[model samples]
Target: MPTTATPYLLRSNTGKNSLKGALDSLIASHINQLGPSMLVQVEAVTASAASLTGKVTVRPMVQQQDALSRPLPHDIIHNVPYLRIQGGSSALIIDPKPGDIGFIIISGRDHTHAVTTRKPAPPASFRQFSMQDCVYVGGFLNNGPDQFIQATDHGWRIVTPGSVTIEASHIEANCDITTSGDVRAGGISLKQHVHGGVQTGAGASAPPQ
Candidate 1:
């Protein structure tokens, strides 16, 4: 009878002697966690007796997500597991891997974290806000915790865990402004500037009524 496959045996078969050895080595170099086990087959050929063959099935381990719902250990998702990247130069489901960079935005709690070769994972906390490049606002409003905001020279952003009111000029590209209360903005920017709060034409905008 043939011996059952074991974790150690699985590793040895796929590591020491097999084509999967090279693949495993490659994966190890790139990812944080090593995948699960795989099957191994050994065959012996002889004229007097039938060939001796052993079969072992190995399965890859599942990876966990981080606080942002992104890969905990961090890795490029191909076409496996719950998340995967489809064929193409675009970042369909997950973010692009190496050589590609961009911004990541999660709407609210429903929004998910995605992996990108260029940008970091998006925020996941309730009322949490984030921007890739910049943010700008042009209006008046109030803000509080459960509410956060960020603006850069690139563009304007608004994140509200609660609510807020503000006014400004030149909203940036990647902006993160949130409020659980109420938010009112005049001009917002996101890139090199993070400007928020009440602003008037003179620099002191009237506070919320």
Candidate 2:
């Protein structure tokens, strides 16, 4: 009768008097208690239409010390999740790759599991702009140099030190137009034109001699 607060001795599955044996024994004895969440190492990954299946080895916690004399037990658990694949949300598709470490949580008595993949370390080319209340994706240009779109409380905003060019088949606007630069409609007829703070209609003509 081992209480939750009681420290139990771990024994290996092979009955060997080694650290590995002790950790294995500890995991075996507390497998049920280790749920409904456990850290797992992804050995293989298979993608289906809706979900991702991972052949993961569960790392069970044991009351023992590591090789460096650290009081942490690292044990490998085989055949975890019972070959079940967990699907992600429709908005986000999760594709877990091999060697991806993650966690699996048992969600139901019938052994339905929920898996979440951990993010890997970013590469040297990856860049990000982070602030106290704002975050922007930097080092990525769109249409011009030094351009970045930032997410704000109001909405998304594109910032650039240079000019911006937008190409679209059609454009629609529901608000008034304001700009410091000149607005030109290429190869299109104009109904009126404003020059030198004076509006000229299409019916206006040049003076005759």
lDDT of 1 by residue, 133-163 (tens): 1111111122323434567798656567664
Candidate 2, residues 1-209: lDDT per residue as tens digits? 86565333432234577667777778886763433444445554444644444333444333356568778654554444323323454333344444545555443332212222333333222222211111111111213335567789998887878887666998898989776655556633243443343346756544221
Best by lDDT: 2
Off by over 4 Å in 2: 1-146, 187-203, 206-209
The lDDT of model 2 is 0.44
RMSD of 1: 25.3
- TM-score for each model: 0.14, 0.28
How far off is residue 18 in model 2, in Å?
5.8
Worst 10 residues of 2 by lDDT: 130-139
Runs in model 1 deviating more than 4 A are 7-9, 13-17, 32-209
lDDT of 2 at 100: 49
**Total clashes in model 2, counting residue pairs 3 or more apart in sequence or in different chains:** 4
Give residue 5's lDDT in candidate 1 (0 to 100). 69
